[model samples]
Target: MEKYLEIIKNSYSSYWNYLKNSVFMELNWENYFYGLIIISLIVWGLEAIFPWRKNQSLFRKDFWLDTFYMFFNFFLLNLIVLIALSNSASELFNDVLGIVGLSIKNFQLLEINKLPFFTRIFIFFIVVDFVQWWTHRLLHRVEFLWNFHKVHHSVKQMGFAAHLRYHWMEPVVYNSLKYIPLAIIGGFSAKDIAFVHFFNITIGHLNHANINWDYGGLKYIFNNPKMHIWHHSRELPKERKYGVNFGITLSIWDYIFKTNYIPHSGRDIELGFEGDENFPKGFIQQEMYPLGRKD
Candidate 1:
Protein backbone atom coordinates (compact mmCIF):
# COMPACT_ATOMS: atom_id res chain seq x y z
CA MET A 1 0.00 0.00 0.00
CA GLU A 2 2.81 2.42 0.84
CA LYS A 3 4.59 1.59 -2.41
CA TYR A 4 1.45 2.18 -4.44
CA LEU A 5 0.89 5.53 -2.74
CA GLU A 6 4.44 6.58 -3.41
CA ILE A 7 4.11 5.67 -7.08
CA ILE A 8 0.90 7.65 -7.40
CA LYS A 9 2.47 10.66 -5.71
CA ASN A 10 5.47 10.57 -8.02
CA SER A 11 3.26 10.19 -11.10
CA TYR A 12 1.12 13.13 -10.02
CA SER A 13 4.14 15.36 -9.48
CA SER A 14 5.67 14.45 -12.85
CA TYR A 15 2.42 15.09 -14.71
CA TRP A 16 1.97 18.53 -13.16
CA ASN A 17 5.53 19.47 -13.97
CA TYR A 18 5.06 18.45 -17.59
CA LEU A 19 1.79 20.36 -17.77
CA LYS A 20 3.45 23.50 -16.43
CA ASN A 21 6.25 23.26 -18.96
CA SER A 22 3.79 22.66 -21.82
CA VAL A 23 1.80 25.75 -20.85
CA PHE A 24 4.91 27.92 -20.98
CA MET A 25 6.36 26.39 -24.16
CA GLU A 26 5.38 27.13 -27.73
CA LEU A 27 2.49 25.12 -29.16
CA ASN A 28 3.70 22.03 -31.00
CA TRP A 29 2.12 22.42 -34.39
CA GLU A 30 4.41 19.76 -35.88
CA ASN A 31 3.02 17.08 -33.57
CA TYR A 32 -0.53 18.28 -34.13
CA PHE A 33 -0.11 18.16 -37.91
CA TYR A 34 1.54 14.73 -37.80
CA GLY A 35 -1.23 13.25 -35.65
CA LEU A 36 -3.88 14.68 -37.94
CA ILE A 37 -2.21 13.29 -41.04
CA ILE A 38 -1.70 9.86 -39.49
CA ILE A 39 -5.26 9.50 -38.28
CA SER A 40 -6.63 10.81 -41.59
CA LEU A 41 -4.54 8.36 -43.58
CA ILE A 42 -5.62 5.41 -41.44
CA VAL A 43 -9.30 6.30 -41.67
CA TRP A 44 -9.08 7.15 -45.35
CA GLY A 45 -7.35 3.85 -46.08
CA LEU A 46 -9.95 1.83 -44.22
CA GLU A 47 -12.79 3.69 -45.91
CA ALA A 48 -11.25 3.07 -49.31
CA ILE A 49 -10.98 -0.70 -48.71
CA PHE A 50 -14.23 -1.31 -46.84
CA PRO A 51 -16.57 1.61 -47.34
CA TRP A 52 -20.13 1.30 -46.04
CA ARG A 53 -21.60 3.25 -48.93
CA LYS A 54 -19.68 2.29 -52.05
CA ASN A 55 -21.68 4.79 -54.09
CA GLN A 56 -20.41 7.71 -51.99
CA SER A 57 -17.39 9.35 -53.60
CA LEU A 58 -14.31 10.29 -51.59
CA PHE A 59 -14.76 13.88 -52.73
CA ARG A 60 -18.49 13.98 -52.26
CA LYS A 61 -20.53 17.18 -52.14
CA ASP A 62 -19.12 19.78 -49.73
CA PHE A 63 -16.08 17.62 -49.03
CA TRP A 64 -13.66 20.55 -49.23
CA LEU A 65 -15.94 22.60 -47.01
CA ASP A 66 -15.90 19.86 -44.42
CA THR A 67 -12.09 19.76 -44.65
CA PHE A 68 -11.94 23.48 -44.04
CA TYR A 69 -14.28 23.10 -41.10
CA MET A 70 -11.97 20.46 -39.65
CA PHE A 71 -8.85 22.61 -39.72
CA PHE A 72 -10.63 25.80 -38.71
CA ASN A 73 -12.43 24.23 -35.75
CA PHE A 74 -9.50 22.16 -34.53
CA PHE A 75 -6.62 24.55 -35.12
CA LEU A 76 -7.93 28.11 -35.04
CA LEU A 77 -11.43 28.68 -33.70
CA ASN A 78 -11.43 26.16 -30.85
CA LEU A 79 -8.15 27.45 -29.38
CA ILE A 80 -9.33 31.05 -29.31
CA VAL A 81 -12.70 30.15 -27.79
CA LEU A 82 -11.27 27.80 -25.18
CA ILE A 83 -8.60 30.26 -24.04
CA ALA A 84 -11.07 33.12 -23.87
CA LEU A 85 -13.65 31.15 -21.88
CA SER A 86 -11.70 28.78 -19.61
CA ASN A 87 -10.30 31.30 -17.09
CA SER A 88 -13.43 33.43 -16.92
CA ALA A 89 -15.68 30.41 -16.56
CA SER A 90 -13.45 28.88 -13.91
CA GLU A 91 -13.41 32.06 -11.87
CA LEU A 92 -17.16 32.48 -12.22
CA PHE A 93 -17.80 28.92 -11.11
CA ASN A 94 -15.47 29.23 -8.14
CA ASP A 95 -17.18 32.43 -7.06
CA VAL A 96 -20.61 30.78 -7.24
CA LEU A 97 -19.33 27.84 -5.21
CA GLY A 98 -17.95 30.30 -2.64
CA ILE A 99 -21.38 31.88 -2.29
CA VAL A 100 -22.85 28.46 -1.51
CA GLY A 101 -19.96 27.80 0.93
CA LEU A 102 -18.94 24.72 -1.04
CA SER A 103 -15.47 25.38 -2.33
CA ILE A 104 -13.65 23.21 -4.87
CA LYS A 105 -10.40 23.73 -2.94
CA ASN A 106 -12.01 21.89 -0.04
CA PHE A 107 -13.05 19.08 -2.37
CA GLN A 108 -9.42 18.71 -3.41
CA LEU A 109 -8.73 17.45 0.14
CA LEU A 110 -10.25 14.13 -0.90
CA GLU A 111 -6.97 13.37 -2.73
CA ILE A 112 -8.35 11.77 -5.88
CA ASN A 113 -4.82 11.83 -7.26
CA LYS A 114 -3.83 8.97 -4.93
CA LEU A 115 -6.21 6.65 -6.73
CA PRO A 116 -4.89 4.15 -9.28
CA PHE A 117 -3.94 5.64 -12.68
CA PHE A 118 -6.38 3.55 -14.71
CA THR A 119 -9.08 4.17 -12.13
CA ARG A 120 -8.67 7.93 -12.47
CA ILE A 121 -8.74 7.62 -16.25
CA PHE A 122 -11.91 5.50 -16.13
CA ILE A 123 -13.76 7.93 -13.87
CA PHE A 124 -12.70 10.93 -15.96
CA PHE A 125 -13.80 9.21 -19.16
CA ILE A 126 -17.24 8.32 -17.82
CA VAL A 127 -17.83 11.76 -16.31
CA VAL A 128 -16.77 13.66 -19.43
CA ASP A 129 -18.74 11.31 -21.69
CA PHE A 130 -21.91 11.65 -19.64
CA VAL A 131 -21.55 15.44 -19.53
CA GLN A 132 -21.03 15.57 -23.31
CA TRP A 133 -23.98 13.25 -23.86
CA TRP A 134 -26.23 15.63 -21.97
CA THR A 135 -24.77 18.60 -23.84
CA HIS A 136 -25.44 16.88 -27.19
CA ARG A 137 -29.07 16.24 -26.25
CA LEU A 138 -29.44 19.89 -25.31
CA LEU A 139 -28.00 20.94 -28.65
CA HIS A 140 -30.77 18.96 -30.31
CA ARG A 141 -33.75 19.73 -28.08
CA VAL A 142 -33.07 23.45 -27.61
CA GLU A 143 -33.97 25.43 -30.74
CA PHE A 144 -31.28 28.07 -30.23
CA LEU A 145 -28.57 25.50 -29.59
CA TRP A 146 -29.84 23.46 -32.52
CA ASN A 147 -29.14 26.39 -34.84
CA PHE A 148 -25.39 26.08 -34.26
CA HIS A 149 -25.58 22.30 -34.20
CA LYS A 150 -27.39 22.26 -37.55
CA VAL A 151 -24.05 22.96 -39.21
CA HIS A 152 -23.00 19.44 -38.24
CA HIS A 153 -26.20 17.59 -39.20
CA SER A 154 -26.26 19.41 -42.53
CA VAL A 155 -23.70 16.93 -43.80
CA LYS A 156 -25.34 14.73 -46.42
CA GLN A 157 -22.31 12.45 -46.51
CA MET A 158 -20.27 11.14 -43.60
CA GLY A 159 -16.47 11.15 -43.49
CA PHE A 160 -13.71 11.32 -40.88
CA ALA A 161 -13.26 15.03 -41.45
CA ALA A 162 -16.91 15.59 -40.62
CA HIS A 163 -16.11 14.93 -36.98
CA LEU A 164 -14.59 18.43 -36.62
CA ARG A 165 -17.32 20.21 -38.59
CA TYR A 166 -19.04 21.91 -35.69
CA HIS A 167 -19.98 25.51 -34.92
CA TRP A 168 -17.41 27.46 -32.89
CA MET A 169 -19.91 28.41 -30.24
CA GLU A 170 -20.88 24.78 -29.73
CA PRO A 171 -17.56 23.96 -28.00
CA VAL A 172 -17.83 27.07 -25.83
CA VAL A 173 -21.06 25.73 -24.39
CA TYR A 174 -19.97 22.11 -23.95
CA ASN A 175 -16.46 22.84 -22.71
CA SER A 176 -17.75 25.36 -20.20
CA LEU A 177 -20.32 22.95 -18.81
CA LYS A 178 -17.83 20.08 -18.72
CA TYR A 179 -15.41 22.13 -16.59
CA ILE A 180 -17.96 22.59 -13.79
CA PRO A 181 -18.07 18.89 -12.98
CA LEU A 182 -14.33 18.50 -13.15
CA ALA A 183 -13.84 21.52 -10.93
CA ILE A 184 -16.27 20.10 -8.40
CA ILE A 185 -14.42 16.79 -8.34
CA GLY A 186 -11.19 18.79 -7.81
CA GLY A 187 -8.57 16.10 -8.46
CA PHE A 188 -8.39 15.62 -12.22
CA SER A 189 -4.93 16.53 -13.52
CA ALA A 190 -4.24 18.01 -16.91
CA LYS A 191 -3.19 14.52 -18.04
CA ASP A 192 -6.56 13.07 -17.08
CA ILE A 193 -8.31 15.69 -19.18
CA ALA A 194 -5.94 15.04 -22.08
CA PHE A 195 -6.60 11.30 -21.95
CA VAL A 196 -10.33 11.78 -22.17
CA HIS A 197 -9.84 14.31 -24.99
CA PHE A 198 -7.66 11.90 -27.01
CA PHE A 199 -10.22 9.14 -26.63
CA ASN A 200 -13.06 11.45 -27.70
CA ILE A 201 -11.18 12.65 -30.77
CA THR A 202 -10.17 9.16 -31.90
CA ILE A 203 -13.59 7.61 -31.35
CA GLY A 204 -15.33 10.68 -32.78
CA HIS A 205 -13.47 10.33 -36.05
CA LEU A 206 -14.15 6.61 -36.18
CA ASN A 207 -17.83 7.11 -35.48
CA HIS A 208 -18.05 9.59 -38.39
CA ALA A 209 -15.92 7.60 -40.79
CA ASN A 210 -17.27 5.89 -43.90
CA ILE A 211 -16.10 2.47 -42.68
CA ASN A 212 -18.51 -0.48 -42.46
CA TRP A 213 -17.47 -2.20 -39.24
CA ASP A 214 -20.16 -2.14 -36.50
CA TYR A 215 -18.30 -4.09 -33.74
CA GLY A 216 -21.32 -6.46 -33.65
CA GLY A 217 -22.37 -6.87 -29.99
CA LEU A 218 -20.20 -4.03 -28.81
CA LYS A 219 -22.48 -1.67 -30.71
CA TYR A 220 -24.59 -1.43 -27.55
CA ILE A 221 -21.55 -0.42 -25.49
CA PHE A 222 -19.43 1.95 -27.60
CA ASN A 223 -20.54 4.45 -30.19
CA ASN A 224 -19.96 3.03 -33.67
CA PRO A 225 -20.35 4.33 -37.19
CA LYS A 226 -23.56 2.35 -37.77
CA MET A 227 -25.22 3.72 -34.63
CA HIS A 228 -24.06 7.32 -35.18
CA ILE A 229 -25.12 7.20 -38.82
CA TRP A 230 -28.73 7.00 -37.65
CA HIS A 231 -28.26 10.05 -35.43
CA HIS A 232 -27.65 12.00 -38.64
CA SER A 233 -30.49 10.33 -40.54
CA ARG A 234 -32.93 12.77 -42.14
CA GLU A 235 -36.00 10.65 -41.44
CA LEU A 236 -37.20 8.32 -38.74
CA PRO A 237 -40.20 6.11 -38.07
CA LYS A 238 -43.21 7.96 -36.68
CA GLU A 239 -43.24 5.87 -33.51
CA ARG A 240 -39.58 6.50 -32.71
CA LYS A 241 -38.38 9.45 -30.69
CA TYR A 242 -37.05 12.27 -32.82
CA GLY A 243 -33.37 13.28 -32.30
CA VAL A 244 -32.49 10.11 -30.41
CA ASN A 245 -29.02 8.56 -29.88
CA PHE A 246 -26.94 11.52 -28.72
CA GLY A 247 -24.05 9.62 -27.15
CA ILE A 248 -20.55 10.94 -27.90
CA THR A 249 -18.15 8.16 -26.81
CA LEU A 250 -20.39 5.61 -25.14
CA SER A 251 -23.83 4.33 -26.21
CA ILE A 252 -24.70 3.17 -22.69
CA TRP A 253 -26.02 6.62 -21.68
CA ASP A 254 -28.52 6.61 -24.55
CA TYR A 255 -29.57 3.08 -23.62
CA ILE A 256 -30.13 4.00 -19.99
CA PHE A 257 -31.94 7.22 -20.89
CA LYS A 258 -34.00 5.33 -23.50
CA THR A 259 -32.88 7.53 -26.44
CA ASN A 260 -30.98 4.82 -28.29
CA TYR A 261 -32.15 4.27 -31.87
CA ILE A 262 -30.58 1.85 -34.32
CA PRO A 263 -32.26 0.72 -37.50
CA HIS A 264 -31.71 -2.68 -38.99
CA SER A 265 -29.50 -0.99 -41.57
CA GLY A 266 -28.45 2.60 -42.31
CA ARG A 267 -27.05 2.02 -45.81
CA ASP A 268 -30.15 3.30 -47.58
CA ILE A 269 -30.96 6.10 -45.14
CA GLU A 270 -30.61 9.67 -46.39
CA LEU A 271 -28.66 11.81 -43.92
CA GLY A 272 -29.03 15.57 -43.15
CA PHE A 273 -31.65 17.90 -41.70
CA GLU A 274 -34.92 17.21 -43.51
CA GLY A 275 -35.91 20.81 -44.33
CA ASP A 276 -32.39 22.26 -44.36
CA GLU A 277 -31.58 21.65 -48.00
CA ASN A 278 -30.44 25.26 -48.33
CA PHE A 279 -28.26 25.34 -45.19
CA PRO A 280 -25.18 27.51 -45.77
CA LYS A 281 -22.48 25.69 -47.74
CA GLY A 282 -19.41 27.78 -46.81
CA PHE A 283 -17.59 28.01 -43.46
CA ILE A 284 -18.09 31.77 -42.93
CA GLN A 285 -21.83 31.61 -43.69
CA GLN A 286 -22.27 28.63 -41.41
CA GLU A 287 -20.41 30.45 -38.63
CA MET A 288 -22.80 33.38 -39.01
CA TYR A 289 -25.87 31.11 -39.18
CA PRO A 290 -26.47 30.65 -35.45
CA LEU A 291 -26.29 34.41 -34.87
CA GLY A 292 -29.76 34.83 -36.42
CA ARG A 293 -30.86 36.39 -39.72
CA LYS A 294 -28.92 39.22 -41.31
CA ASP A 295 -30.55 41.84 -43.57
Candidate 2:
Protein backbone atom coordinates (compact mmCIF):
# COMPACT_ATOMS: atom_id res chain seq x y z
CA MET A 1 0.00 0.00 0.00
CA GLU A 2 2.79 2.40 0.83
CA LYS A 3 4.56 1.66 -2.48
CA TYR A 4 1.32 2.15 -4.47
CA LEU A 5 0.66 5.44 -2.69
CA GLU A 6 4.21 6.63 -3.46
CA ILE A 7 3.80 5.74 -7.13
CA ILE A 8 0.50 7.62 -7.37
CA LYS A 9 2.01 10.65 -5.66
CA ASN A 10 4.97 10.70 -8.06
CA SER A 11 2.68 10.38 -11.06
CA TYR A 12 0.53 13.27 -9.88
CA SER A 13 3.61 15.40 -9.24
CA SER A 14 5.02 14.66 -12.69
CA TYR A 15 1.73 15.50 -14.38
CA TRP A 16 1.42 18.73 -12.44
CA ASN A 17 4.96 19.73 -13.34
CA TYR A 18 4.31 18.97 -16.98
CA LEU A 19 1.12 21.01 -16.97
CA LYS A 20 2.92 23.90 -15.33
CA ASN A 21 5.94 23.85 -17.61
CA SER A 22 4.33 22.91 -20.92
CA VAL A 23 1.22 25.02 -20.60
CA PHE A 24 1.51 27.85 -18.10
CA MET A 25 5.21 28.44 -18.52
CA GLU A 26 5.06 28.71 -22.31
CA LEU A 27 1.62 30.26 -22.80
CA ASN A 28 1.60 34.00 -23.41
CA TRP A 29 -2.05 34.69 -22.66
CA GLU A 30 -1.56 38.45 -22.83
CA ASN A 31 -0.20 38.38 -26.36
CA TYR A 32 -2.86 35.96 -27.51
CA PHE A 33 -5.72 38.01 -26.09
CA TYR A 34 -4.32 41.32 -27.36
CA GLY A 35 -3.64 39.95 -30.82
CA LEU A 36 -7.13 38.48 -31.08
CA ILE A 37 -8.66 41.79 -30.05
CA ILE A 38 -6.62 43.83 -32.53
CA ILE A 39 -7.31 41.47 -35.41
CA SER A 40 -10.99 41.22 -34.62
CA LEU A 41 -11.33 45.00 -34.55
CA ILE A 42 -9.54 45.43 -37.85
CA VAL A 43 -11.45 42.70 -39.69
CA TRP A 44 -14.79 43.69 -38.23
CA GLY A 45 -14.13 47.27 -39.27
CA LEU A 46 -13.38 46.20 -42.82
CA GLU A 47 -16.47 44.03 -43.01
CA ALA A 48 -18.67 46.85 -41.77
CA ILE A 49 -17.33 49.48 -44.14
CA PHE A 50 -16.99 47.46 -47.36
CA PRO A 51 -19.91 45.09 -46.94
CA TRP A 52 -20.68 42.34 -49.48
CA ARG A 53 -24.34 41.71 -48.81
CA LYS A 54 -25.75 45.19 -48.54
CA ASN A 55 -27.81 46.14 -45.44
CA GLN A 56 -26.49 43.14 -43.57
CA SER A 57 -26.22 43.74 -39.86
CA LEU A 58 -23.24 42.84 -37.70
CA PHE A 59 -25.49 40.81 -35.42
CA ARG A 60 -26.71 38.63 -38.26
CA LYS A 61 -28.02 35.12 -37.79
CA ASP A 62 -25.54 32.70 -36.18
CA PHE A 63 -23.08 35.52 -35.48
CA TRP A 64 -22.67 34.73 -31.80
CA LEU A 65 -22.61 31.04 -32.58
CA ASP A 66 -19.71 31.58 -34.95
CA THR A 67 -18.01 33.68 -32.29
CA PHE A 68 -18.41 30.82 -29.82
CA TYR A 69 -17.03 28.41 -32.40
CA MET A 70 -14.05 30.68 -32.98
CA PHE A 71 -13.15 30.79 -29.30
CA PHE A 72 -13.83 27.09 -28.70
CA ASN A 73 -11.78 26.02 -31.73
CA PHE A 74 -8.79 28.30 -31.08
CA PHE A 75 -8.63 28.30 -27.27
CA LEU A 76 -9.85 24.86 -26.24
CA LEU A 77 -9.83 22.32 -29.07
CA ASN A 78 -6.84 23.46 -31.14
CA LEU A 79 -4.62 24.20 -28.16
CA ILE A 80 -5.03 20.74 -26.66
CA VAL A 81 -5.29 18.54 -29.78
CA LEU A 82 -2.60 20.27 -31.87
CA ILE A 83 0.02 20.28 -29.12
CA ALA A 84 -0.62 16.67 -28.11
CA LEU A 85 -0.86 15.25 -31.64
CA SER A 86 2.09 17.24 -32.99
CA ASN A 87 4.42 16.19 -30.17
CA SER A 88 3.31 12.56 -30.36
CA ALA A 89 3.59 12.43 -34.15
CA SER A 90 7.00 14.07 -34.12
CA GLU A 91 8.29 11.57 -31.56
CA LEU A 92 6.73 8.63 -33.42
CA PHE A 93 8.11 9.70 -36.80
CA ASN A 94 11.54 10.38 -35.33
CA ASP A 95 11.65 6.90 -33.82
CA VAL A 96 10.37 5.23 -37.01
CA LEU A 97 12.83 7.15 -39.19
CA GLY A 98 15.67 6.35 -36.81
CA ILE A 99 14.95 2.62 -37.21
CA VAL A 100 15.32 3.02 -41.02
CA GLY A 101 18.61 4.92 -40.47
CA LEU A 102 17.25 8.12 -41.99
CA SER A 103 16.70 10.95 -39.54
CA ILE A 104 15.23 14.39 -40.16
CA LYS A 105 18.56 15.97 -39.25
CA ASN A 106 20.50 14.01 -41.91
CA PHE A 107 17.84 13.49 -44.63
CA GLN A 108 16.12 16.85 -44.52
CA LEU A 109 15.17 18.14 -47.97
CA LEU A 110 15.50 21.82 -47.10
CA GLU A 111 17.22 23.49 -44.20
CA ILE A 112 14.43 26.05 -43.72
CA ASN A 113 16.15 27.83 -40.86
CA LYS A 114 19.19 28.51 -43.07
CA LEU A 115 17.04 30.37 -45.61
CA PRO A 116 16.27 34.08 -45.44
CA PHE A 117 13.41 35.05 -43.13
CA PHE A 118 10.84 35.98 -45.82
CA THR A 119 11.84 33.00 -47.98
CA ARG A 120 11.41 30.64 -45.06
CA ILE A 121 7.97 32.11 -44.39
CA PHE A 122 7.00 31.76 -48.05
CA ILE A 123 8.07 28.14 -48.19
CA PHE A 124 6.31 27.23 -44.96
CA PHE A 125 3.19 29.04 -46.10
CA ILE A 126 3.01 27.25 -49.46
CA VAL A 127 3.74 23.83 -47.98
CA VAL A 128 1.24 24.14 -45.15
CA ASP A 129 -1.37 25.69 -47.41
CA PHE A 130 -1.06 22.82 -49.87
CA VAL A 131 -1.60 20.37 -47.03
CA GLN A 132 -4.65 22.32 -45.91
CA TRP A 133 -6.03 22.38 -49.44
CA TRP A 134 -5.71 18.63 -49.76
CA THR A 135 -7.23 17.99 -46.35
CA HIS A 136 -10.10 20.34 -47.15
CA ARG A 137 -10.79 18.48 -50.40
CA LEU A 138 -10.80 15.23 -48.46
CA LEU A 139 -13.29 16.65 -45.99
CA HIS A 140 -15.67 17.41 -48.82
CA ARG A 141 -15.14 14.17 -50.71
CA VAL A 142 -15.48 11.72 -47.84
CA GLU A 143 -19.01 11.37 -46.52
CA PHE A 144 -17.97 10.62 -42.95
CA LEU A 145 -15.61 13.58 -42.96
CA TRP A 146 -18.27 15.74 -44.55
CA ASN A 147 -20.51 15.07 -41.56
CA PHE A 148 -17.96 16.81 -39.33
CA HIS A 149 -17.09 19.47 -41.93
CA LYS A 150 -20.76 20.25 -42.43
CA VAL A 151 -20.74 22.19 -39.19
CA HIS A 152 -18.66 24.78 -41.02
CA HIS A 153 -20.83 24.80 -44.15
CA SER A 154 -24.04 25.18 -42.17
CA VAL A 155 -23.39 28.83 -41.77
CA LYS A 156 -25.87 31.08 -43.64
CA GLN A 157 -24.06 34.31 -42.94
CA MET A 158 -20.33 34.63 -43.40
CA GLY A 159 -18.33 36.91 -41.12
CA PHE A 160 -14.75 37.26 -40.01
CA ALA A 161 -15.32 34.91 -37.08
CA ALA A 162 -16.98 32.44 -39.42
CA HIS A 163 -13.54 31.39 -40.67
CA LEU A 164 -13.05 29.40 -37.45
CA ARG A 165 -16.57 28.04 -37.34
CA TYR A 166 -15.62 24.42 -37.76
CA HIS A 167 -16.01 21.15 -35.90
CA TRP A 168 -13.47 20.52 -33.10
CA MET A 169 -12.17 17.47 -34.95
CA GLU A 170 -11.04 19.68 -37.86
CA PRO A 171 -7.77 20.78 -36.27
CA VAL A 172 -7.06 17.17 -35.37
CA VAL A 173 -7.40 16.24 -39.03
CA TYR A 174 -5.54 19.22 -40.49
CA ASN A 175 -2.67 19.62 -38.01
CA SER A 176 -1.93 15.90 -37.87
CA LEU A 177 -1.05 15.70 -41.58
CA LYS A 178 0.24 19.26 -42.07
CA TYR A 179 3.62 18.94 -40.36
CA ILE A 180 4.81 15.75 -42.07
CA PRO A 181 6.11 17.49 -45.20
CA LEU A 182 7.58 20.25 -43.07
CA ALA A 183 9.32 17.65 -40.96
CA ILE A 184 10.78 16.07 -44.08
CA ILE A 185 11.87 19.51 -45.32
CA GLY A 186 13.58 20.15 -41.98
CA GLY A 187 12.41 21.83 -38.83
CA PHE A 188 11.36 25.45 -38.93
CA SER A 189 12.29 28.05 -36.36
CA ALA A 190 9.59 29.37 -34.06
CA LYS A 191 9.68 32.73 -35.90
CA ASP A 192 9.00 31.14 -39.30
CA ILE A 193 6.03 29.23 -37.91
CA ALA A 194 4.70 32.45 -36.37
CA PHE A 195 5.07 34.29 -39.65
CA VAL A 196 3.05 31.67 -41.53
CA HIS A 197 0.45 31.63 -38.78
CA PHE A 198 0.04 35.40 -39.03
CA PHE A 199 -0.57 35.24 -42.78
CA ASN A 200 -2.96 32.31 -42.35
CA ILE A 201 -5.00 34.15 -39.75
CA THR A 202 -5.18 37.27 -41.91
CA ILE A 203 -6.09 35.42 -45.10
CA GLY A 204 -8.59 33.20 -43.31
CA HIS A 205 -10.33 36.25 -41.90
CA LEU A 206 -10.49 38.02 -45.25
CA ASN A 207 -11.74 34.94 -47.08
CA HIS A 208 -14.71 34.53 -44.79
CA ALA A 209 -15.42 38.17 -44.12
CA ASN A 210 -18.45 40.00 -45.55
CA ILE A 211 -16.29 41.75 -48.11
CA ASN A 212 -16.27 41.60 -51.94
CA TRP A 213 -12.80 41.87 -53.42
CA ASP A 214 -11.42 39.45 -56.01
CA TYR A 215 -7.93 41.06 -56.37
CA GLY A 216 -8.48 40.81 -60.17
CA GLY A 217 -5.95 38.47 -61.85
CA LEU A 218 -4.21 37.95 -58.50
CA LYS A 219 -7.23 35.83 -57.51
CA TYR A 220 -5.57 33.00 -59.44
CA ILE A 221 -2.59 33.17 -57.06
CA PHE A 222 -4.05 34.16 -53.69
CA ASN A 223 -7.53 33.14 -52.57
CA ASN A 224 -9.83 36.10 -52.14
CA PRO A 225 -13.23 36.47 -50.50
CA LYS A 226 -15.05 36.32 -53.84
CA MET A 227 -13.36 33.05 -54.72
CA HIS A 228 -14.07 31.53 -51.34
CA ILE A 229 -17.70 32.68 -51.37
CA TRP A 230 -18.36 30.25 -54.21
CA HIS A 231 -16.87 27.53 -52.07
CA HIS A 232 -19.84 27.99 -49.72
CA SER A 233 -22.40 28.03 -52.52
CA ARG A 234 -25.24 25.58 -51.97
CA GLU A 235 -25.26 24.21 -55.51
CA LEU A 236 -22.06 22.84 -56.95
CA PRO A 237 -21.25 24.09 -60.43
CA LYS A 238 -22.13 21.88 -63.43
CA GLU A 239 -18.52 21.08 -64.33
CA ARG A 240 -17.31 19.83 -60.94
CA LYS A 241 -17.83 16.34 -59.57
CA TYR A 242 -17.20 17.39 -55.96
CA GLY A 243 -17.03 20.91 -54.60
CA VAL A 244 -14.87 23.54 -56.28
CA ASN A 245 -12.38 26.09 -54.90
CA PHE A 246 -10.73 23.90 -52.26
CA GLY A 247 -7.66 26.09 -51.79
CA ILE A 248 -7.02 27.69 -48.42
CA THR A 249 -4.33 30.26 -49.30
CA LEU A 250 -3.50 29.79 -52.97
CA SER A 251 -6.09 29.26 -55.72
CA ILE A 252 -3.39 27.85 -57.98
CA TRP A 253 -4.08 24.35 -56.68
CA ASP A 254 -7.78 24.64 -57.52
CA TYR A 255 -6.94 25.90 -61.00
CA ILE A 256 -4.44 23.13 -61.60
CA PHE A 257 -6.90 20.51 -60.36
CA LYS A 258 -9.74 22.05 -62.46
CA THR A 259 -11.87 22.71 -59.37
CA ASN A 260 -11.85 26.48 -59.77
CA TYR A 261 -15.32 28.05 -60.19
CA ILE A 262 -15.96 31.75 -59.90
CA PRO A 263 -19.13 33.41 -61.16
CA HIS A 264 -19.14 36.97 -62.43
CA SER A 265 -20.67 38.07 -59.14
CA GLY A 266 -21.33 36.38 -55.80
CA ARG A 267 -24.21 38.77 -55.07
CA ASP A 268 -26.85 36.17 -55.90
CA ILE A 269 -25.06 33.32 -54.16
CA GLU A 270 -26.89 31.62 -51.32
CA LEU A 271 -24.57 30.08 -48.79
CA GLY A 272 -24.99 26.94 -46.60
CA PHE A 273 -25.34 23.28 -47.45
CA GLU A 274 -28.63 21.91 -48.71
CA GLY A 275 -31.01 21.04 -45.83
CA ASP A 276 -28.76 22.94 -43.44
CA GLU A 277 -31.77 24.84 -42.21
CA ASN A 278 -32.71 21.66 -40.37
CA PHE A 279 -29.36 21.69 -38.63
CA PRO A 280 -29.03 22.98 -35.09
CA LYS A 281 -28.29 26.64 -34.37
CA GLY A 282 -26.75 26.65 -30.89
CA PHE A 283 -23.05 26.02 -30.33
CA ILE A 284 -23.52 22.92 -28.17
CA GLN A 285 -25.98 21.39 -30.61
CA GLN A 286 -23.69 22.11 -33.54
CA GLU A 287 -20.78 20.52 -31.67
CA MET A 288 -22.89 17.41 -31.18
CA TYR A 289 -24.33 17.48 -34.72
CA PRO A 290 -21.77 15.41 -36.63
CA LEU A 291 -22.53 12.34 -34.47
CA GLY A 292 -25.48 11.30 -36.72
CA ARG A 293 -28.13 12.23 -34.24
CA LYS A 294 -31.65 12.74 -35.65
CA ASP A 295 -32.30 15.48 -33.15
Q: Each model's TM-score?
A: 0.84, 0.86
lDDT of 2 by residue, 203-248 (tens): 8888888886877889899888999988999887555646889988
Over 4 Å off, model 2: 1-30, 293-295
lDDT of 1 at 19: 40
**Residue 239 displacement (Å), model 1:** 4.8
lDDT of 2: 0.78
Name the candidate that leads on TM-score: 2
Model 1: clashing residue pairs?
none
What is residue 54's positional error in candidate 2, in angstroms?
A: 1.5
Q: Write the per-residue lDDT of candidate 1 for residues 48-100, one digit (tens) a residue.
A: 89899998897867778888888777756634455545655566666778998
Clashes of each: 0, 0
In model 2, pairs of residues that clash are: none
